[model samples]
Target: MRQDTEVRTFRDGPSPATRRRVLAGGALAAGLGGVGAAASEARTAEVGGVRHGTVRADGVDVFYREAGRPDAPVFLLLHGFANSSFYFRHLMPRLADRFRLIAPDLPSFGFTVVPDDRGYVYDFASLSRTVGAFVDALGLRRYLLYTFDYGAPVGWDLALAHPERIAGIVSQNGNAYLEGLGEAAWAPLRAYWAKPNAAAVESIRARMTLDGVKAPYFHGVPDPSVIEPESYTLDAAILARPGNADRQVTLKLDYKRNLERYPLIQAYFRERRPKLLAVWGRNDLFFIPPGAEAFRRDIPDARVRFLDTGHFALETNGDDIAREIRDFF
Candidate 1:
């Protein structure tokens, strides 16, 4: 039993390089217009005519990609670490045609633009509040959630805090419980949380690889030239910023903080009982399959599906995931 049990992770786990992988990307389209406005127009045209928008929160500007008419049912999408709002690019169009889709770049990541002189902290609770504020700012009465990776905690907490406003939940490769990790797999994050300093930061950054980034999903090709070089370059730039490393390490520290709050989050999901869906990249090396299993154990009546992809399953199997979310509505 001990030997067999040695193989799991999730219900667990952060770092300096960890910080870089997490907050590595933002935008300043408070109105999703002007320079962003023209881009939104092009996006709408690309996706069969949806809306483009940006929101201002805390001290940063958040750029968002939305589709469908404002009056339609709402679908709120959240992304994971080391990723910006770009994770949902392909999926947005597919669902935007049927529902009011809203995808934000969060605060420190993406083109929404972070403040030059301020220190930004990206914790689950902080991000949760950011999302909540964005939802409230848009005046969305209630909306479905599409959460992935780090997004699951942020969005889940938001839904728990505001159950009245949640329609249903669609999660892919997200964690909602404790005790889900392998020791080797979780070491770096644990170290980062313990010591979020410069050395830790550089050490973690050095291990990241193009192949490593795509290892989370179960896709057909291992080398997708589209994502590797450019994404890593963008993330490298963010890591170079002053204090940005610490902001990222703070996000890693939240793993323990979030784990402590896991029971409450599960209770919220149980008592409120929103429609929950789980999609996974069977190939994810970090947050393994058991994480999905734990979510099902608590989220009673969750619809779970697995894909042969990596961590960012949305990038590879977006259309199918988007359809699953739309069908739920």
Candidate 2:
């Protein structure tokens, strides 16, 4: 389904003119009525062709955003840290006509709810299991996996477990190589991994603030003004939930496990030889450009494309990335 590549607003209440004016004035924070208001509005109903729903999976309520026809080839979009399926709000609609897009909020992020009694472990392996349960509950037998940030480890885990289920992979700033680790930006995480002391944990927790949430979105973008403020604002609001900070800290510590699994993931790449596409943000400080280039070492035919954006490439280059996926697939 082709969509007009004009400035479009996702909310139902705002007129196009009013939305444009509000965006121009840089008052979206006020117009969005803070985090509570923005998240509440998003939860109320579907916007554009995207529909929101929840399914019980592995004792956790897995919330997801879905679009496109039920029978279309599946595109399982797994988001990164501090983000939910909401991150795909723009890109899903753009590709809904061609692919069945399903972006699920992992157990800890977004709208997914974990009961206090469930005692869910906030680690990559557990998260991958929950996502596997989610996929089974949805009856998705085969799909094209889209991995970013934290999603890389989870998606790779799935691929390693059930190699027959994945049709292909699209890695957007999803690093699987040690060389891809950006030492400067990852100092705090590395420090936490080295020592899970109070100071180390506090350093990682400090990034849960509003400014820290905004950092990845603004870091390498040539024009920060084009970024929608609601993106980070909503993430900050979600991170502020009670007990959420500790959950994130736990995940940060467990990230070392993902690093350890890099060799195994590379083996999967060589043996399975799944169709792969790496669309990277050249300026991403967390996952460098070499991460994208490394995919070619295992699968010589893998396609890699770099966009002049920051960590969140879809935020700035959604249309271009969408076009690339359509052409490559």
TM-score to true structure, per model: 0.75, 0.85
Candidate 1 lDDT by residue in tens digits, 224-314: 5534445545554655566655666567656777777778878887787778888877677667777777766777688888887767776
Using TM-score as the measure, the top candidate is: 2
Candidate with top lDDT is: 2
Instruction: Please give the CA lDDT of all the candidate structures.
Output: 0.61, 0.80
Q: Can you give the lDDT of residue 268 in candidate 1? A: 84
Worst 10 residues of 1 by lDDT: 1-10
Return the TM-score for candidate 2, rounded to 2 decimals. 0.85
lDDT of 2 by residue, 171-210 (tens): 9999999989888988877777776678877877888999
Q: Quick one: how many clashes does candidate 2 have?
A: 0
